[model samples]
Target: MSDTTTNGAADAAQAPQIKMNVLAQFIRDMSFENILAQKGTGGETQPDVQVQVNLDARKRTPDHQFEVVMKLKVDSKAKGSGDQLFLMELEYGGVFHIENVPDEQIHPFLLIECPRMLFPFVRRIVADVTRDGGFPPLNLETIDFVSLYRNEMMRRQAATVPADDSASA
Candidate 1:
C-alpha cells in the first residue's frame, strides 16, 4: 500500500498541467476600398453587401503556443448595375497559450474554442472599418465554430476518397 501511494505521488508530480491563455491579439491585415469614389458622382441607390468569412489556425513553434486567424472579405455592389461600391478585407489573429492538451484534441481546440474567443474582436473591427468607409456599420452575425469544423472535416474526407466508378460500369 505504501509503495503504491509513493508511485502515484511521483506520477502526479511529473505530469504537465492543462492550461490556456491569450498572449496577444492583432489585426494582421486590413484594407478598405470605396470603389465608387473613383467613378463619377452619380445618384446610386442603396448597395447590397455580401460578406465572406474564413478561419485558419496553426500551432506555433513552441509546443504550447498557437495562432488563430479569421479572414473576412466584404463586397458591396450597386443593386441595379452590380458595380462594386466597396471592397473590404480583414485578417485578424491571436496568439494563444495551450499546454498539456492531448495531441488528438489539439486541432479541435484550436479551430473551435480559440476562434470563439477571438471572434468578437474581429467582428468589432469589421464593423468599425465599414463605418469608416462611408457606409453604415456592418455587424457580423455569430458563427457556429463547431458546425464549421464538422463541415470542414467532412469536406476533407470527401476530397480524399476517390470517386467509385465501379458501380457505374
Candidate 2:
C-alpha cells in the first residue's frame, strides 16, 4: 500500500502542467471600403453579409513564443441588386508564450486556442469598422474553433491524397 501511494504521488509530480500567456496582440493590417457610397447607390436596400476566416501560426524568434494570425474578409452586398455594399479585410496577430504543451499538440493549440484568445478583439474591430464605414454595426457570431481546426485538417488531408486514375478505365 505504501509503495503504491508513493508511485501515485511521483506520477502526479512528473506530469506537465500546461501554461499559456498572450504577450501582445494587434491588428497587422486592415482595410474597409464603402462600395455603396462609391457608386452613389444610396438606397434602403436589404444587405447580405458574408465573412471568411483563415488562420496561420508560426514559431517566432524565441523558442517558446509563437505568432498566430487570423485573417478575416467581410463582404456586404445589396440583396436585390447583388451589388457590393462594402468590403473589409483585416489581419490580426497575437504573440503567445506557451509552455508544457506536447510537441504533437502545439500545432492545434496555436491554431485553435491562441486564436480564441484574440477573437474578442477581432470581433470588436470588425464591428467598429463597419459602423464607421457608414453602415449599421455588424456584430459577428461566436466562432467554433474546434470545428474550424478539424475542417482545416480534413481539407489538408484531402489535398494530399492522390486520386485513383484507374477509375477512368
Candidate 3:
C-alpha cells in the first residue's frame, strides 16, 4: 500500500468510536460489623434479621454512558433486647459504555442486566457477614431487578399525580 493510504487507515483505527464494554467491576466499599459482640460475650440468642435495599442510578456523563450503583444495607437485631447483632453494607457498581443504543435497550441495560451482574457478589457478602457474626450463615433470597425497577418507576409516577380533593371539599 502507498504511504498516504496506510496513514489514512491508521487514523481511522485511532478515531474515537463508540465501543461499549464494562471497564471495571468491583466492590467500591464494604462494611460488615458484629454489633451484638459489643453488648456482651457468649451464648447470645439469635437476632431477628432486617434487610434494607436501596437502588440508585445516574449518568456519569451527558453523552451515551452511565453508571448504575446498587447499595444494600442489612441490620439484624435481637427481638427482645433490640440489641443489634449484625450490620452489613455493600456498594456495587458497573461502568457501562452505552452509545447509540436505542431508548428501549437502555432501560433493560440499566434496570435488569446491571443489577443481575452485581447480585451474586452482594449475596455472598450478606452470607459471610452473618456467618462471621457467629450466627448461621444467612442466605439472601434472589432479587427480581426488573420487578423492583418497574415498581420504583410506578411509585415515582404515583407520587407526582395530584390527588383529587373535590370529594373532601
**lDDT: worst 10-residue window of model 2:** 160-169
Per-residue lDDT for 1-169 in model 1, tens only?
9999999999998998878899999989999988787675556468888888788988789868999998889898989889888899989999999988899999999989989999899889888888887778888899899998999999888876645544455
Winning model by lDDT: 2
Which of the two candidates, 1 or 2, achieves a greater TM-score against the reference? 2
After the best TM-score superposition of candidate 2, give how far the Cα of residue 165 lies from its true spot, in angstroms.
7.3
Q: How much is 153 displaced in model 2, in angstroms? A: 0.7
Instruction: Kindly list the per-residue Cα lDDT of model 2 for residues 9-110, writing each as its tens digit.
Output: 999989988989999998999999999999887968799999999999999999799999999999999898899999999999999999999999999999
The superposed Cα distance between candidate 2 and the true structure at residue 82, in angstroms, equals: 0.7
lDDT over C-alpha atoms for residue 47 of model 2: 93
Candidate 1: regions farther than 4 A off: 1-18, 42-44, 163-169
Query: What are the models' TM-scores?
Result: 0.80, 0.90, 0.71
- Among these predictions, the greatest TM-score belongs to 2
Which consecutive 10 residues in model 3 have the weakest lDDT in total?
Answer: 160-169
Clash pairs, model 3 backbone: none
RMSD of 2: 2.7
Q: Weakest 10 consecutive residues, lDDT, candidate 1?
A: 160-169
